[model samples]
Target: MDNDIKNFFKEIRKLDDNIDIPAFEEINIKRNSPRKEYYALVGIAASFLIVFSLFFTDEKVQTETNDTDYVITLSDENTTNTESLILEESSIYSWEAPSESLINNFND
Candidate 1:
């Protein structure tokens, strides 16, 4: 396994050495246009104008009063029925080993 991996890497290195790589070239970047800057300034001014108008505008919030009234009445007839209920006692369970006759019955 080690010899196979070493031979594979040696082949890759020989192939890499045989290939010709190109030289690096310089890249030229142009400056930003004045029209784009003007548009950005106009957009910023429009956003600021919108924010200031929202803060300074006079807006009246009208609240309506609820005229309907609600009344709740509780009765004492439903509170006197808990004394007639009956409850059963719970049974306790214990584990027991099986008998030798029960095991012999299964074997037959």
Candidate 2:
């Protein structure tokens, strides 16, 4: 088996030596459109305009003042007629675990 494998590899190596491989070629990629540069300049100009408007603009805000007064008057007779509220008792609920005897009765 070893001799057969060695003979197979020798044949493969002889075939590999006879095969021709291609040579490497240098490729140069260049941009053919100037729209990318124009877009970038436009974006930069827009950012600068926004920054200048936020920092250099001077605008005054005017607020109006209201001097009107509001007065509410309550009658003494209406204040004296107040009624009391009555509440009824409600039942309370409690939680308890099952006793050992109950568990044993169920198991039986």
For model 1, the superposed segments whose C-alpha errors exceed 4 Å read 1-26, 58-108
TM-score of each: 0.29, 0.28
Error in Å for residue 97 of model 1: 99
- Among these predicted structures, which one has the highest lDDT? 1
The numbered model that scores best in TM-score is: 1
In model 2, what lDDT does residue 12 have? 100
RMSD vs true structure, all candidates: 24.9, 22.0
> How does each model score on lDDT?
0.71, 0.69
What's the C-alpha lDDT at position 73 in model 1? 60
lDDT for each residue of candidate 2 in 6-88, tens digit (9 for 90 to 100): 99999999999988765444344566469988998999999999987766553211111222334465767666776676665
lDDT of 1 by residue, 4-61 (tens): 9999999999999978776444344556799999999999999999988776563321
The C-alpha local distance difference test score for the whole of candidate 2 amounts to 0.69
